[model samples]
Target: MVKMGTFFGMSLGAFVFWQSMDKVHVWIALHQDEKKEREEREMEVRRVREELMQQAQQRDSVA
Candidate 1:
């Protein structure tokens, strides 16, 4: 009976540990995705700014 109880306790503990690890894994993945999205947005903004600057320069030269 003691052995059976011990086994059940260990099983429950292992299950809890696995659940915690899964939560951590999901959290990290979400942050990574957010970071990538943010970086892409920044790159797009930079590209647009550069294009606008070039257009302004061309207009000035023409004038």
Candidate 2:
């Protein structure tokens, strides 16, 4: 008696694995870029609001 194991064809397995990894890489990259842009926008908004508030306080103090 002999025992045999099942194996996938090599090229097909490689291609399917590569495709799945590529998709995941693309998704992660896009998500990271989106988060960075959102953070930058929020920072800019905060900076502008702070500047305006400081100016208002200075003017009120001088009055």
Candidate 3:
């Protein structure tokens, strides 16, 4: 009877651990995707700023 209870307890613990690990993996994936999007937006802003600076320089040279 003790052996049967031990087996049942181990099985339950293993199932709970598996579920928690699966959630952690999903959270990591979502975090990575958000990081990628943020980097892309920053790059776009830098590009636009450079273009504006170039245009202003050209206007000043003409004046």
For candidate 1, write residues 1-63 as lDDT tens digits.
999999999999999999999999999999999999999999999999999999999999999
Better of 2 and 3 by lDDT: 3
Clashes per model (N, Cα, C within 3 A): 0, 0, 0
- Better by lDDT, candidate 2 or 1: 1
Instruction: State the lDDT at 53 in candidate 3.
Output: 100
lDDT of 2 by residue, 1-63 (tens): 122222445666888999999999999999999999999999999999999999999999999
- Residue pairs with clashing backbones, model 1: none
Model 3, 7-50: lDDT tens per residue? 99999999999999999999999999999999999999999999
lDDT of 2 at 27: 100
Global lDDT of each candidate: 1.00, 0.90, 1.00
Residue 47 miss distance in model 3 (angstroms): 0.6
